[model samples]
Target chain A: MNEGAPAGAELLEVRGLSKFFGDVAAVERVSLDLARAETLGVVGESGSGKTTLARCILRAIDPDAGSVRFNSANGWTSLHSLKEKELVPLRREMQMIFQDPFSSLNPRMTVQQILEEPLLIHGERKRGKRVAAVREMLSRVQLGADALTRYPHAFSGGQRQRIGIARALMLRPSLVVCDESVSALDVSVQAQIINLLEDLQAELGLTYLFVAHDLAVVRHICDRVLVMHRGRVVETGTVEDVFERPRQDYTRLLLSAIPSPDPDVPLKPLDRATLNL
Target chain B: MTAPVLAIRDLAVEFKTDTGVTPALSGVSFDVPRGQVTAIVGESGSGKSVTANCVMRLVQPPGRITGGSIRFAPDAGDAFDVVKLADRDPRLYDLRGGHISMVFQEPMTALSPVHDIGGQVAEAILCHRDIGKEAARAEAAQMLERVGLDDMERRMGMYPFEFSGGMRQRVVIAMALVCHPEVLICDEPTTALDVTIQAEILTLIRSLQHELGNSVIFITHDLGVVAQIADHVVVMYQGRVLEIGTVRQVLKQPLHPYTRGLLQAIPGVVPPGERLATIASVVGDADIETPHPLVALADGRQVSLPPAQLRRVARS
Candidate 1:
């Protein structure tokens, strides 16, 4: 359990994180911090290494270099330095909502089985308690009890994502990395899931590492933004500061690329010549 | 009004399963103007892609075009009903890639992993035109460069896997346009790419459309894309055309409740939570009924709204 790390305290911290696959540096010297309850958007295009950075921080994959510090009820734990057995307890605090709802969830498993697995893994031996927790989480996501028997294949993209969120919350994790969670759903369904995410964050005081390619969704959901380019942080600032008055040309270029829904807002897309960065 | 480059009248398609028949498209109709982008916007099962598939005569087995006429009036060819021709007919063969080529969502599916980029581009040209290998290759290189894939001498020799997603998409665009098709059907062409890359691809398409003067039937669920490039908008819901109008008319003053719901659902269009269920309680029963005949406006725009919906818009 996160044993009272103080209100508004830093939940997670990373410094000079880097990972290399052969000659290519997927994430190079990336540093960031997350407050107790804040949504930080990690914005990038393909090959930008935002996903690799998140994976490294969560210890889903090992980072070649740098450090990670996480605060729990046991106080500050140096996560990068911890061994596998020692890290097991801390693993429950960090969970992930994946990009594809279809592939991320197993088609064979019922919603009850899917949601209850996390609790079972974290040593909730009592079957009734696990089911109750799953039920509670499902309701929080606006899916009722009747969904318990349904398979992932039976549900729509939006409902499947809700199940994914419920699965992520079974352990009541403090940090949930939403990796393009809403992007795959249809426009209307995307809005519903986003609103659900927002509501859950407020209710549970969750810290979010939102990695996405959609600028409009990022702008709406996130409080602060980190712009990544070619495995490096190009800019990190408040959403307004980065969006309205971006410093680097690359950041400006990313901003310029977002297609506005309003037709009257003339498209001044930066030329493909500028994509070399 | 001048005849549109393509007229889709009462388009209907059905997908038959062992259980029963599912009407993928029922009474869908719209007109695509000459040298302009007509965007068909809808959710997943809304039959937007079905409409596009029917146009190219690409709908496969079990999915049959039951009724409708896709009157394709190309720049130089005589107007013909695409539905009347068999899937493998000679006339249909000429129309499929030679005149109306399609760009799919996944470029990898269209492109061959084994073949060199130059070969694929040249193959597209050689299929439709009576040209030699070297001439086709030369034309392919020119087109590859035209779509902004530079260093063609080296890059053209590389396979589709060697290129990035955006680059592969550019090659797909180059292939679709190299044949000099009068009609380009882009079905969610940029849905898989990054926003920056998507923007770039969109710009390239718009610019080339201007240069070639080919009418484009852009099928996308993204209204932002529809707003960005579409001259006309076709809104669909549950396998039918909810409304049809210019981008201005459809987006600014949507005659259908579903269109309004979709537009409002775009992030930042409305407050977060409220936009979630906007479509649920909205869109009355009367508006969704079949037999919706398009009502023309003083402007070039048209809508298939019910009397109540039309009156509501008029008052607003």
Candidate 2:
């Protein structure tokens, strides 16, 4: 997200999005805007409905109420209003990357088959073109072409994640929803993947909804941060505003909980009792 | 200086697989001081867990301790050589739960799904102490409460599946500390938990260790966790101990090439938009650059070599 992004151009907009599982409200009337080529972070504890909110925006699972409007090449389109048949082409523009690279990717499939599958699903049937696209994506993700022949089990967790990224970027999606994508990796490998994500975003002008529990990662990658607590958005601001001067007690508690790598800064987690968490 | 509670010297472990022998730990050595948290930090397959398993005498089958001496120095009397002990040694049973215990990353694997929390914790107490069931249960209740689990009586009756991941980890800690083990091996205990839960657990473990005055061997890849809890740090890579010192010394002034690269490459520590310092992916011998006589930290005053990798070649 840089100078090329149109001023005040909105790529995706969610208005009062809500989802409930039986009696429980998984996501409660959440509203946010993702600018073109901007990376927005969603941070919260487990079971705080961040994942549900992401799913609703992507229409991976339908929201019970509210509307999701995405600015397609054709212009503004309501994602929820589109029928399943009409949603097919747009689905390519909105893709998702998962946390566990091991389980998300098919163990039986080679890297080639895995990357090519997405193109096939979107109706790109030419074998030569699919192979070429897959190779290009692989290089972009910093994985070599030799990796195409190996199974997921053959690669390390980091390498498998790179393959996963390559697969997600194969269709050149405009928006990518990364749900705890880098959380599972070690710090070093996590850095490598983050760098790759940043590079790919810069080159291809991709928008990312990076959902993670690590506040440091959110601060590092996202232009703005959204803090969620038990199915509601508690805070949303620029990374500096939320991290340095958080308005909500819940946001402050989450920020206080992050362990600084510096030894001099002792970890001081706020008491849950104080915030009534 | 007081003798260390655990002393590992020239530790070498290997697996006799179909492909051939693969060394897991070769000449890994470190001293874990008494009442201090010594963190063994390494990436995946760095043999941190293997070292823990070897110390616990839990390694089986093709996995073998080819060479080493793991000495457990009790507060009183003789220093027992752990590596020389037989598989069925009766003392291993006592030393395990009585003196040393482990809390793992996955709490589910440690806690039985069928067993009630109280019963499992009480069983551990009974295993090490000559106590009645009622007395053991009472002590178990205290342990559970100490681990930050409120409503211990009610939670004790619940099964593993009924509790959240963080709550279950507390139960695991309770069972591990039931016998009051002198050495606690926590292998990435907070790795699976969220940041808030991780902070709480780290605090709990630190407080418990402070209260009990017992030594802890915490194995993790997260440098931030090491900074949070460790008094002493041991940096390992590919089964070798590359650097060893107090946490301040290791983290603040890293001497090894790999350690330097690791510290600089972390995301949050460095300002955003700057490209992170990266170590070479292939890391057999880190003498990739021309050996300079010195290396710099923040100001490059210490010695001038490559800004990231070490200038000098030898640690010995």
Candidate 3:
């Protein structure tokens, strides 16, 4: 069945997706589309199911129902129900970068080992050329060649993240989900990483699902934005549309909750009038 | 402006590394007026924590303040210089927690892992005041209650691990205030907590500041937290003060380019795939060549800057 676009037009799609933990629905009837080479940001507070949805898409955790489909060079395929053998090769088509750079990268492994491990497991790149590929990826991420010999501990928090991004891109995945990638970094380092990601996306034709709680960071990077509250998508629109004119009351509250750089601007007093208690 | 209870002038800190000396703080000067809540905002490695540690004389080995004077106004009219005091002086110990307490970033590591939560809170009270175990326990419970811990008595006996992230922070707050210190230094106290919990904690700190009328030095990267709590803001970079002004002035009409860039870097409250506004250059990368060591403003106050050759100076 031909959808709104051609067979390989859309990069990824989630239709009526829901994840249930016992009796409660973690994600309820969620649907979204990510076009090829687009950066989509997902904004939400903790426990908003943004992470759960990312897990469901990555198939790190299976979704209880609905479908996660990917459009690739071969054809469009549903990822939600794929068995291990079937999904093995397709796993290369998508990858994820976690929030904490410390835990995400193996401390014991040298940067060389960490970079090579993914290419080895994915198997698209030949084993004989893996070293060269590893070095290439390192340089692409703006890291020096000398970094190949260093351990994770030797690098600062920002440098560790560049390595993390390099590791995720080693598979040549079509999509990367950066879940709070810069939240742990200091401000200057965060800016460096953001610029690196932007440059990489332009060069590599990569699409990103940028999930973070920091509104200013989201403002700087995402092309389109969505706001999640509790377990639902309270507001969804282009970054300009949502920030300029948020429709939902909850969206407004979340925006207001964001602290502005102007210290003189009075904090949106927590609406004591609105608190149920 | 109210007279500063804690006045620091020409403050500088140096760490003796194997390669020589690394100047972490240089000519850092500021005033924390009594009854005011001031925020020292900067990125990581900007020496925000070092400034806090210097004030407490908790600078570890190889790290020492080679220069500067930290004056604490005498309650009865005289003043004492903090840097001149010995590291282990009884007076320094006496001032700590009793006159100036601190709450660190991570509550999990800050609290004793083996001790019951109540024991830790009571210990802080016992250190500053002459009190028996029963009296300390009662004070601990009451302190916990003041910091918004419900069922405070029951929670006291529980270990730190058993408490939620927010509750553990509350316990730390209780411990800090157990002695009713005149000034409080909170170094990213809510960094580990969720937004809703952070909101609650910010609200609590504001209320406590109002009630006690003590000065506060809040060190954090989150401008939102700064907005919610700070009466004045200190923007620091590379261990030096970049901009110091009223919170409104810094946020609304930032003078230093670094300050402006920092304000621009906050993510807009929306989802991704949108055009996010970003500051063009990183903080440490910018270079400004100005002849004057300190620029004089219309008010006759001079703002300090690093050397002209140094690339870290903030532009106009």
Candidate 4:
């Protein structure tokens, strides 16, 4: 359930999105919609085209077919048809956070530079205004002003992730796609980041496309979930429905495979009918 | 109680970095019961991996065992202290892979890209046994089949790159078990795999361990994995063993505050709309008060608490 937006307005809508690498259809005929301020989770195994779908939406990788319609401040914009130069301004409306905190951020740049790069690129040339924006974004992510001068190497995995989150939100984007954002962190740190993401979503009315392979993490944060298998969407439903009463056998297998933390509770057996050997 | 197959007592390990000697493990003690899966669980920098390295005597240079003994008892021979054995001692050759083998987290790197599957598996067998190349290859083929690899004959010729993540892991398992070692150390063996593949690997390991009756040292950070597989769990934090008990005792009724913090930190276990309990909320600041005393909770779970804090709680 999306909140804080107009009753029926969709933040993002995808129609028959597809990408192929050689003979492999990395993402095949995928369609999904995201309401404003809603967190739509895309879940699948490593080769399940979840990353391909995210990249296609971000236009980081060009897609072979289909349309990505975003309801921008101006109105609905067709992202798929736009050229590189035309897509430059629209890029400010959408941002992405990568999985590996260690490698994602430019190591040589200070936190201020990393956060301010986007604003500078989007043509905010005033030094004072850029620094102010950077400081404000840092505090929003719960980092102190001192972090502005520190390089990415100085921050811990959790802190680096916070910096990543702050950088993604610095541009004040309508939609932020987090690709396995917290997967690299430890359990405690993961919880901290997840909470931070939720808080930011509520505060800024930001729509999120949270992509991950971990079902439990997706269940914890997502409003609705999309399950992908072998480059195709196998199921899509509310988090409760997808997890509890999965329509697809593949979804059930994925849910069952999650190791239960309680020792007293036995592990769900691998459903052979679902697995199909 | 039956004597543990492997008994580690007051083990201390230190890494001699350029800065100084950093303690990796300090006075850690645990026992791997015969034919049971004993999990060493902890986050990064917690020394679980160091413990596994210690068991296999695979700790690289700059890291050394400072104190304590790792006594391993074989099914038919006298118990020997692993710590006392020299790094290159010929006797260690008989112990390392012959009796104690290891499986790593990433199977891609673990399995050689250049070598054929059968050749690698056969090499593991040949290292510990006085078998001919043909016999070793036959044994490797049989092992591959046991690990659920299809078309063992043709599959044996395949390289590591030819297999999927799950299949590569199976190949690694086949290599580790070819010698039928008494103790198998799996260091986050399934962390790189998908959920379904992970389940299959865990099941395969469990069933193989059952049939082979080997003691297993499973190292992982996920409590969910420890729940499904471990018979006994060792919770380590900053090189110290916080809690050592059955899986039920540790997972359901955790003794140590750190263990409790770890268990509570798992997402999706708690009901919706409620914030997941965090270790930061429990531990507060980084510096913990010293000389902690073990306190028994209402549910009979024992947890170490600072004496002054316990007294303050009592007075309040």
Chain B TM-score, candidates in order: 0.94, 0.90, 0.89, 0.92
For candidate 4, report its TM-score: 0.94
Best candidate according to TM-score: 1
**Global Cα RMSD, each model:** 2.4, 4.5, 4.3, 3.4
DockQ of 3: 0.40
Candidate 3 residue-wise lDDT, B1-316, digit = tens: 6578888887889899899999888878888888899899988778899999988888987998889999987455457888998867777887788788999989999999999988998998888888899999998999888998778757888998898888889889989988888789999999987665677788788899898777899999988789879988888878888777787767766667677777765654223433333455424465532322445455323345555522333343
Candidate 1 accuracy as lDDT: 0.87
**lDDT (tens digit, per residue) of candidate 1 on B1-316:** 5688788998989999988999998888788888899999999999988888888888998999999899988777689899998657888878878999999999999899999999999999988889899999999999999999888899989999988999999999999999999899999999999888888889999999999999999989888888899988888888888778888888898877778878887886754324344455355454465546667666656667777667666566
For candidate 4, write residues A1-277 as lDDT tens digits.
Answer: 1223333448888889999999999999998889988889999889999999999998999999997788877778788777899889888889999999999999999999999999999999999999999998998899999999999999999999999998898889999999999898898888888888888889999999999998888989889999999889999989888888898878878888889998877676566555683
Stretches off by above 4 angstroms in model 2 are: A1-9, B281-316
Chain A TM-scores of each predicted structure, in the order given, are 0.95, 0.95, 0.93, 0.95
Which residue pairs come into collision in candidate 1? Answer: A2-A73, A3-A73
- lDDT per model vs. reference: 0.87, 0.86, 0.80, 0.87
Candidate 4 local lDDT, B103-185, one digit each (tens): 99999999888999999999999888887999999999999999999888789899999999999999999999888899999
Per DockQ, the best of the predicted structures is 4
Candidate 1 off by > 4 Å: A1-9, A271-276, B271-278, B281-293, B314-316
Per-model TM values vs. the true structure: 0.95, 0.93, 0.85, 0.94
- CAPRI grade, predicted model 4: medium
Instruction: Please report, as a residue range, the 10-residue window in candidate 3 chain A with the lowest summed lDDT.
Output: A1-10
How many pairs of residues collide in model 1?
2
User: Lowest-scoring 10 consecutive residues by lDDT in candidate 3 chain B?
Assistant: B269-278
